[model samples]
Target: MSLARRSLMEAAAARFGWRRAYGDTTQVDALLTEQTETAYSEAADHAALATAKNTDALHLQPCVLDVRGRVLGDALYLEGLLSGARARGLAPELIERLEHAVDHGHELTVLLADTVRTTTAAHATGH
Candidate 1:
């Protein structure tokens, strides 16, 4: 999940021209992964199936956020942490722990959602 999220962040960064201010030249590869033919095939298949079935499986409802809050495009600030890790040469174990913390934070978001008011983007924006 972290790997996939990092790729999305890279894409967003490229699209928005976010500069890589710091990072080493050395490349780190994941030593552990399933021997799949393609990384995105399963996700693609699920998305296609959901679309063909006209299901809400891939549907997204807008998150009603604070008006004053800034829109950090990446999920749970993982991208920022990843950049920091690279800049400071942090250990992989610490990065993994941080990823776990983000997962926990997402769990909290789900738990806290019921307490907050929510509406569609159209409704929230009076569109």
Candidate 2:
């Protein structure tokens, strides 16, 4: 495993108070996959909620923008991690998952932009 990946795994273990088995590549891979999925899932849910029509988009604009920024930053970080994984010849599935997470962030950005525009228009028209 790459140093970056190993460090991330170790940090996660520390944060979660989980025991780490030294030199266990399988466990490292599993933890990476699970963490990637969980982060993506949470970002996806937040994006959906922020863009939902029933939401008070106008009132939530600041918070939504902050979340969008965070998601984009996370996607960029994942891209770096993906590069490291590729260089290290990691599993194809893990690389694919990283790509998916990055794509989701990009999509969320677009969705948030549209929602903000619609909300701005509605507010201007006194709707």
Candidate 3:
């Protein structure tokens, strides 16, 4: 599920139903997933049989989001968290961005951060 969709569902659950919300969602998700897999299988088979050729296989790629954009986005999210904590007179133990990067380890993090920075720079330079 997408983050936005999950957030909306969570908000709805908080505002409306109290019980079995996730349980209901789980059942629905399972059933829908089963149905979708079956449909895709049938469709793929029919296409291949009709064309008498191998169907083109699509590959899923891993996505690396921009570090700066993600950091700025997290800052915006902290505004929400901090505001909520302040309203309830509580101090939230939020993780700092540097700490998060460090937690991912040195070598892997360098490569990941490089990818984000490279992409952002490329986009900025209109490449």
Candidate 4:
């Protein structure tokens, strides 16, 4: 993962008390998928922010896992950005900023997850 993303994830995790675990990538992936769908759908519907409910399930995912579980932390950060934007009463431009933040977080999570998975696979194969 890029250092910037990693740093952002670490900061977000610390802010939210996410425990880094070694086996949470799958869950994190699931959360990201859900968040991505929600964000896209919400944008498609052009829903007003005040009336919109967040992709609750994605936000509720457990973040207190090992290094493997840190994907959920990234997902949570993205969710927070979305929720924050919505909570701010949805000024059009602010909403756009929130969307960008969430997208960035998702990209970082994917990179981190890929790295974790590759490293784990290499170790398993005794590379």
Candidate 5:
């Protein structure tokens, strides 16, 4: 996870007194695969990011991961994911930003869930 993402998760956890986020990893993995592929095909943002990553590293799988991460790293995405992660919150900004991402299967919900879980684990064990 990036430092910025970790910080965002930490901020949300502290602000909301949230516990560890839990979800079905198998489902998440499947969804991530399907949605990521879809994003790669459909989302212009993903193409641009992937191209940028390719130019940066000229690698393969890692570049794909970076593209997804970049899409999820958007402030609007993080905000929406963070808000949805908690029991009570919603970000209008995120809702507005969703026009391109969710429709394109960014799997942002799964990303948020994973990010929440990572943050929870870090806080739980003092890692």
Candidate 6:
């Protein structure tokens, strides 16, 4: 993983209450890289299979329909955190950027979860 992605993941994890399990930078970097690569591979495999079956549109229909609901939930979650941070009188610019990042993270989380769930279901049903 690139330094930027690793940093972003670390920050997002911290924001979401994921503690650092490894104290050393080397260990943390290795873990993050491994986990990210695994996730990417899983997502790619899911996408390839879905494409091969021409099921991408069908699988994504729910997400497309619920886009607004998902975004609103993510925004409210982020806004609550930002409001708390702001109450502490922290830097406004940093809070704004963090809120944006959190929203992006939420989207990624939802997409990844959907892909994983779809792939798992396909495998279980021998699809």
TM-score of 3: 0.25
Tens digit of per-residue lDDT, candidate 6, span 1-127: 6968977998999999996577798987888798899899899887787577656444654554466467657767787878888888889896988788777867766775676577567756767
Off by over 4 Å in 6: 1-35, 53-59, 66-71, 102-127
Model 5 local distance difference test score: 0.59
Query: Against the true structure, what is every candidate's RMSD?
Result: 14.3, 8.1, 11.8, 20.1, 17.9, 10.1
- What's model 4's overall lDDT? 0.64
lDDT of each: 0.53, 0.80, 0.55, 0.64, 0.59, 0.73
* Top candidate, metric lDDT: 2
**How close is every model to the real structure, measured as TM-score?**
0.29, 0.56, 0.25, 0.37, 0.23, 0.44
Better of 5 and 6 by lDDT: 6
Which candidate do you rate higher for lDDT, 3 or 4? 4
Candidate 2 lDDT score at position 112: 78
Tens digits of lDDT, candidate 4, 1-127? 6747866897899899895654688867865786798789887565554236524322212221243356557667768867977887778887887687667767777766676566556656755
Better of 2 and 6 by lDDT: 2
Query: How high is the lDDT of residue 68 in model 1?
Result: 14
Between candidates 2 and 4, the lDDT winner: 2
Question: How many residue pairs clash in all the candidates, one count each?
Answer: 0, 0, 0, 13, 0, 0
Score candidate 3 by lDDT. 0.55
**Which digits, one per residue and each the tens of the lDDT, describe model 2 over residues 10-76?**
8898999886664788876887897898899899887787577546547776776777788778878
Per-residue lDDT tens digits for candidate 5, residues 54-88, read 44222443444555566656745555665564434
Ranking by lDDT, best first? 2, 6, 4, 5, 3, 1
| lDDT value, candidate 6, whole model | 0.73
What's the best-to-worst order under TM-score? 2, 6, 4, 1, 3, 5
